[model samples]
Target: MTNVERFLNQVRQSSLGMKRLVVVAPHDEATLLAVEHARKELSIDAVLVGEEEKIVAAAELAGVCLMPYDVVATYGDSAAADCAVRLIAEGKGQVLMKGLIDTSILLKALLKKEYDLRTGRLLSHVALLLPPQGHGYYLLTDAGMNISPSLYDKQQIIENAVDIAHALGNDNPNVALLCAKEKAYDKMPATLDAVELQALNLAGDITGCTVSGPLQLDLAVSAQAAMMKGCKDPVAGNVDIFVAPTIEVGNVFGKALKYMGGYVYAGVVVGAKIPVVLVSRADSEQEKLLSIAMACVCTTSIPMEAGRMMPEMESA
Candidate 1:
């Protein structure tokens, strides 16, 4: 089994206590089906927030039963967002989810004062892709958030990925700052920031991970490519997270890997009070189950030391 499946199996064997997940827009068919499976099969507890009739309708369409869980019975996506956030803050749930609702609505609710879930850190989305051909899984960041990030934001972005890597059980994740070019060119801002991130890792400003930078996609994954580039570092060609220069770059590259390479994908919003799962609408039920499993794996690693996500997760 994959590390994710193992985690889900663990969740299956004994929940210790069922963890609560506040699913916003739970009325959506895909969202409801995923939640129901997570609850019944994986030992997760959920509070569904959406229009009551629509939620029930979606469940019926999906051929899944949703009546067992608490339904918040809210109207409209905005109202569902409000209820989901309130559920989290009221200690009714530990995690948040997005459904058919706009991500902005859920994010706005999460960032609100009453929720008290913010850690004063920018929340970024990280996708874990287990591309079928490759043995190593990869971390794709900001695919759902941070449209255009600056150097400072990239630092936080790396921090978020590092945290995720640790949560997934890597002791010290190796991170690569990805750019089109492989070296820091003073004129190219991406390369420059990559160099800066490298410096931070070297100077100990960034901990729990080995940071290397100005690496092209090849150098981030292929050791032969790193050797060909004459790059010398433990992180060369073996990075846990690839920090893309922009969300466009990350999004495009990630989709390329998924569509062209047929990757099994899962994602979670990081730097939040708890892991927030968001699956692709086009993903399969197995993919959605894998996403929830990945979230549970990350959640279980919360008490461990940071930077433990490298090497622990391999393909099924």
Candidate 2:
């Protein structure tokens, strides 16, 4: 089986037992179709929060029957977001999905103090990509959030991505901090940060992964390239996570892989009370379904503290 298929199968076999997925403003056909697929294929219960009339229309457009799902009526996008977040806070759902609502609206409601969803960690986006011909998955992080992450922010980003890697069954993933060169130069800040991050990982400050850095893109992913460059880090040729220096690099890298390399991806926003399935409207239904499954798996594995979800980095 392909790595994506195996990942999906693992999620299906997990003992999560019918997680409830709350979708905000699911007034679009893509969202409705994805939720329907998740409900049928993954055995997930879906709660759709939006205008009932619009949801019914979307269901019809998508050829999805809503008889088996719960539909919560709301007047507008803001109301839908608020209602969905409130449901999750009340433990009515285990996953939050972004649908037709503006991301800003959904995130605003999610960050409200009343919901108590914040764990004081930065929220970062992680995309799990299946290469066209590769045998495993690659995680690309901070693509949709944290535009210009400082060194500390990058550390949290890596920790968040490591949490995802663990959910994917990789207990100790190989992480490569992407840079333009294999050696840190005085003028290149990213390369310098990469060196520092590698040192932190070696010092037992960053846990659960083998970190390597100051590697160019080719060296990070291609064993042949690493060999040609005389690089010796084990992570050089077998990276499970690629940490981008900036959001622009990550965004362009992910889009290139999806648009040009024929890679399928499942994306989620981590460091929240629960995993958030956040995908573009243009993404295929398969992508959305995989994203929901990924979130479900994360909900079961992410650690909790004092009755609240706490990221491993925070508790570290």
Candidate 3:
């Protein structure tokens, strides 16, 4: 699979008339700069919603021209979020991004039943980590949403991450159910959950990806770690997605990678009618721009499941 830089280049080089992005409360410097990069690099049309004066000033600070965008005047973040989501529901925008507003406020507007964005699937966060020394990107899921997802929630999370993998040009992604050890103990619920998820994939209850479970983080990403342990797991070294047992795990690990391990990342909310770019306020401009590119790439096409590896998922 291609790395983050390569994948972003592919998105940049795609045909014009890219997906339209609607940003709520777009008055922040980083957000404005990132969207400006998207506008110039990917040809994404933008709809900026917020206090028009503030948005214009911030865009100027970021050296971004707002002339090409539809800047909607709104009173506050709450109103901006509502207005942006309404525009999306009206087909004026193809993607929604959070900007200079609380994510909860944005999500509240998005989840309103009247908006019709829900597909009856759980919304989860997937972050694409671009390790400074790696050849490809690593995906970490449910990091920003779902505090402690149930087994069923994990299923949907995996499905969402798989969709992202497909968007990144990997038709069949390898998933690693990350755990503390390489074995399941009855007392460890995460280990047990891993076992069941792996079984589901093996039995075809999950489709479109290869799943392996109860693997420690090292083994999941390092071929040498698997070799040192005398393990011959197919997904051990080449896992595309790392399924964190809990939100804390994913969140802390991703931050550690960025702050301590020198990795850049892009995060988005999935399982909506369209992909949602939701980067942190502290994220660098590059991270925010990459998130926009990631969301746009995901708008391409859906991955269809053929005869599943686990044929029984067809009936399940």
- How do the candidates rank by lDDT, highest first? 2, 3, 1
**How well is each residue in 193-303 modelled by candidate 3, as lDDT tens digits?**
999999999999888899999999999988998999998989998899999998889989888998899898888887777778976667787788888888887766433
Q: Report the CA-based lDDT of candidate 3 relative to the real structure.
A: 0.82
Give the runs in model 2 whose Cα sits over 4 Å from its true position: 304-316
Stronger candidate by TM-score (1 vs 2): 2
TM-score of each: 0.89, 0.93, 0.91
Counting only residues 3 or more apart in sequence or on different chains, how many pairs clash (N, Cα, C under 3 Å) in candidate 2? 0
* Deviation from native of the Cα of residue 187 in model 3, angstroms: 2.1
In the range 1-316, model 1's lDDT, one tens digit per residue, is 6645654565455442557778887666788888887776677788888888888899889997766888878888777888888887787887788788777667777767666766645677788887575255778887767777878788878888888787666779989888888777987899999999899889999889999888888878889988987877788868888888877888888888878977777778766566777765798887787677666655554331222111111111
TM-score of 2: 0.93
How close to the true structure is residue 3 of candidate 3, measured as C-alpha lDDT? 61
Report, for all candidates in order, the number of backbone clashes.
Answer: 9, 0, 1
Q: Which candidate number has the best TM-score?
A: 2
lDDT score, candidate 2, position 156: 81
